[model samples]
Target: MPNDKNNKTELPRNPELTPPCGPVKGQYRKGISSYKGIPYAMPPLRERRFKAPEPMPPWEYLRDCLKPGHTALQMGGILVDSPGTYQMEGKSEDCLFLNVWTPATNPEERYPVYVFIHGGAFATGSGTEMMYDGTRMAQEGVVVVTINYRLGALGFLATHGLYEEAGTTGNYGLLDQIQALRWVQENIEAFGGDPEQVTLGGESAGAFSVTGLMLSPLAKGLFHQAIVESGSIFSIASFAPHNRGDLEKSMTNGQLLCETFGTRDTTEDLYKLRRIPGDVLAAVSMVKSDQSVTPKAFCFWPVYDGVVLPKDPVKALAQAEINPVKLLLGYNTNESSLFIKGHTNLGIYKMLCIEIFGPEKATAVMEHFPVDDDHTPLERMLEIYTHSAFVVGMVMMAKKYASLGEDVFFYNFDYDPAILKIVGLNTAHAMELPFIFGNGIGQHRATKISNLSWIMQSSWVNFIKTGNPNFKEEYKGQVLWPKFDPEKKDIMVFDTHLSNKALPYQEDLAFLEKIMFGNEESV
Candidate 1:
């Protein structure tokens, strides 16, 4: 017989694990209600493959939003029980679904909405990834919505005659994002969220999408705040062109892809290209995305299309016409290490550099990069690549936006688990996601990071609640977070103990800037 003192009540069911059986899409998990696999637009198929997203017809029945909808046909990077081994099972062309998590179902209650776009280089990735489950944010008294948009060749392949026929061509994925936002504008209120207070955010290519939405005239009035994580102008040619040319770069890549698929770069052939199965196109896109950075850049990223993207975002930021919204932007410390392959010897490193940059220029660059016992030649070059991809652009964009009288907050994600560091991926790209999303790191999961994760997610929730990330009243203690203005240059470092740090990496930044922008005479 159980004693009264030792008796324990059975725990209630996890709300997230329980999906509503009714037509209204929702599941109960953790104390939050989630609506999964809710379609935001009609599925892109057949002739609709490369065209703009058409409006989703209203379903008469209560659509069961129980399970996660299909992910777009993309390269597999799903984090299964282990970190890898993502099989393509449910991915399909009918992948324009979104998941919503909210604390309340009552329409009278209005919570701030956070819309997250997933990152996979604008090619692969779905909102269904467990890392982005909105239950955590929803539990914190905010609405968190994750979306799945189109990707790769089907989403970004541009054609001239198709443009003439459809009146809008590529960046259909971007348009899908816009439609999702539009759906939120129309329906989030019913989910107990305020459409007026929406924050658009993403990591990697998702972050690129956020920036694109920030500058897009179509997205002008849609979102009130923006968050960019590890996205910058120098990430790749597709995200940002090295030059200001419009369709030339994207068109060339599109042509190559067309040729590879046995379709010509002609108006009539575009019809044939559209007929290519979604799975086939997605497979080809995955192969193309693996191409080396040199030779021809073939990423299917959004071009500076006149319709979707009014102007080059980098150029637009330079002109100071970017929509004035409260912005929270950041990058990890060892971003380039995500792509760096470890080398056993310095000769191989030098040879690879010479191959990439050519002999003379490689020699000059090699001489500039220092190598020591602790910092290997490979590590030093990875630092340079890190500075090139994340740091330089973060500084430039932060300074530019802050100087323009818009509110900006900056941080550097430096917290990494020993397990990840053991594998040579310390504070690598998108490594901050688990901490940010309240999911602990793999194998290294413990209570040690709980406090730090709490602080970060709390600040994010507060930022969603209000433009400022500071929530002294909720903290039960005073916490000061300063803005990242040109004058102050203040940055918050997320690590063991939160502390403010002055901007670092000046010398490497100067050298890289000179290499990128300086002429021999100018120097």
Candidate 2:
């Protein structure tokens, strides 16, 4: 156990600890000891670029983990200025670092672990982002971990030559995530974390990663629980221009990228691509257009690489071939508001709908969210995207988990702060993040935001600790969050007052289910 002596003089100012990987020095702050910028995998540069991450070799010296490390190479301005904004500085290809925040570093003290993955559409964002600081969550009695994985073409380019060399191509970012989890499994105990009690959680693309990891055989037994916020395999299936997990499209994109880099898809060219500067590769891989608006938005996304991701996640989930874990997942009410911006008339909205769902089904889907006096074209478009990209997908995942007799809890985050309301992005995508991390809210509405944050953090911690959100004594009088039932579709609505209710868009989701899943009774 950590020394309970609260006096500043009683604690070591700079603590040195030894984990399996190496001895590391960390700083003590507020009641938590943070070990930042711990390298979990070898630098993915030069010969290692576009390859599976190699475990970082143990060091004989005491490594300095006091400062933040480099983030995966990515283009700037990819993140929005919402609560979800992340720092994009100190970018590099040698970015396989993870940070840990723990109340104590006593190996005997086993606290539940919460490993967070950042969301950036799989192209941007970093674990070192200020918004992802794990101090507050660590204060709540659990060890918190955040990680960095390679992004964009540097992490996901797939090609025939690359496959011949590595036996698989693409999904390298996913492989990076898996490597991070393996590190947690091997070393979290030194940070006073119970590796067996680790809960993998994320929002948006991170949530997409949680689902991806759940589907990957390589990630099995890495995490015992999952908290998927605002995404699923269904989100990727609904949003990606090509089919979800389409390796062929990824390979074609890789060939195009090679051509863009003035090289052919040869073994020698693979070596040449690795030698190119990281910044130049990141700039070349940037997705210039808005993914939500552009139907053919070409981006460096994960592929169904036969090794890392053996098959399409949606198909794997449908076949009940997923890692069995207690699930707590949901989406915000206005998840699409962040992505769908600028001049969007009814014509563009209709075209986008037709592009996503075929012309035959587009008309039917439009009828569900019609533009009238109360609803503008933009409002309708955002609503359609919110449901299609986030809500329906989460609900489908919840139902599938429930069918498998897994402990699944579903939620709908509708707590809209006044600050966001003034900007017309109420309860937008990643709005729940501030509450979850207990940071980023302005002081004007501090009390209300703090109250919601308390509820979110407490519930999340409880779930991580016991696999049940309603396990705490304070939640006894409140509406008991019930397990999601496929028939009833029970949803825990997080708003001014917490309530257990039926899902909001039942009929719409059923229609979408039919459209997306071809009227199959089984999801």
User: Which number leads on TM-score?
Assistant: 2
Would you list the C-alpha lDDT of every candidate in the order shown? 0.72, 0.81
Model 2 steric clash pairs? none
Clashing pairs in 1: 15-28, 15-29, 16-28, 16-29, 23-62
**Model 1 misplacement above 4 A:** 1-23, 78-87, 163-168, 238-246, 287-297, 344-375, 441-446, 474-479, 510-523
Model 2 has a clash total of 0
Off by over 4 Å in 2: 1-10, 81-89, 287-292, 295-297, 358-364, 367-375, 441-446, 475-477
Going through the candidates in the order shown, the clash numbers are 5, 0
Cα distance off (Å), candidate 2, residue 228: 0.4
Q: Sum up the clashes in candidate 1.
A: 5
Q: What is candidate 2's lDDT per residue for 1-523, written digit by digit as tens?
A: 4345353123376788889999999988887889999999999888999899999999999999999888888774445543222324577888999999988745578889999999887878888888889988887788999999998788878877798788899888989999999999999888889889999999888998998898889999999999999987666655665535588877777887788778888787788888878887776665422444654435677788877778876677788888999999998988877777657788888877887776788898888778889998888888788878787777777888898999999999999878888877788888888788877754233476676677787789889888998845654237788999888888898886788888887877777878865756633
Best by lDDT: 2
Model 2 C-alpha RMSD vs. true structure (Å) is: 3.0
For candidate 1, lDDT tens digit of each residue in 1-523?
1112223222223232222222465566665778888888888887778877887866667676778899988764422223232346788988899988887644467789999999876777889888998887777788899999998777887666566566656688999999999988988877778889999989888887887777788888899998888876334432334222246666666777778878887778877887777777776656222111332344577767777877766667667756678889888998766655575257755654554444666676677885777778777767766676567666667777788887889998888879878988788888888777886442223455777777778888878888888766654323477899685578888886677877777666666555543422110
